[model samples]
Target: MEEQAKQKLKNYVLWLLSRQEYSRRDLTFKLQKKEASPEYIESLLDWCESLNYIDETRYCEGFIRRHLAKNHGYARIKSEAGAKGIDKTLLAFQIEEMEIDWFQLARTAYIKKFSNITDTPDYKQKAKIVRYLMYRGFNYEQIEFAYTHNQS
Candidate 1:
């Protein structure tokens, strides 16, 4: 009966992985929700890792790429990845490997949102734009560059 349960858990994990990537913690949480035995879940997770069926680094890279496509800055991406149980060192390494220009991405996001406003904005409008950019996860430096250079 225990063997049968383990097989069922393994099948479920395989099916989940086939559909999409999942971090180790994410998979563990899913199995726990199904009330699987903790020992069985741990053993299966180890097996999966040994076979490279679940890789945290690969998951981090995909997560970063998807968020980047949405124009999210480094701070937001890192925070999201961390929440997903990804390692900070691994995520930072992946972001560095991508060689992303955050300032450029900030400018692009600003332009995409404010393309219609051609004239210089008043003080209140400037404050609003800055707040918008900050909420989009850009740091002050990137936001400043985007605000000043995007107009020209």
Candidate 2:
């Protein structure tokens, strides 16, 4: 019976993986939702990892690439990766290897969102844009750099 349950869970996981990349935690949560035995879930996760069917590094790289293409900053990327159960050490290494340009990304994001502006915005407008950029995960330095250099 336990073996049957584990096999069912494994099939479910494979189906999910076929749709998109899932972090180990994400898979565990899904199994738990399906009432899979915790012990079996852990063992199954281990088996999946051993098979390289669930590579966190590959997931992280693809995640960062997609988010970066959408112009998300480092902070946002880090936070999202952490929340998705990526190992912090691995995430840090991956981020470093990616060699992202936060400042340039911030500028591009700002420009993409507020491209109609032709002059330096007033204090209120500046504040609004700053808040938007900050919410988009850029640090203060990067946002300021974007604002100062990109504003015509």
Model 1, C-alpha of 122: deviation from truth (Å): 2.1
Per-residue alpha-carbon lDDT of candidate 2 for residues 1-152, written as tens digits (9 for 90 to 100) = 47787778889999998899888888999999999878888888899899988998998888888889988888888898878778888888988998888999999998898888767777987898899998889999998888777764
The lDDT values for all models are 0.88, 0.86
**Model 2, residue 91: what's the lDDT?**
82
Instruction: Estimate, for each residue in 1-152, the C-alpha lDDT of model 1 and write its tens digit.
Output: 37787788889999999999899999999999989988888989999999999998888888988998998998888788878878889988999999999999999988988887677767887788889888878899998788777775
Badly placed stretches (over 4 Å) of model 2 are none
lDDT score, candidate 1: 0.88
Q: Lowest-lDDT window of 10 residues in candidate 1?
A: 143-152
lDDT for predicted candidate 2 compared with the true structure: 0.86
TM-score of 1: 0.92
Model 2 earns a TM-score of: 0.90
Prediction RMSDs, each to the true structure: 1.6, 1.8
Query: How far in Å is the alpha carbon of 23 misplaced in model 2?
Result: 1.1
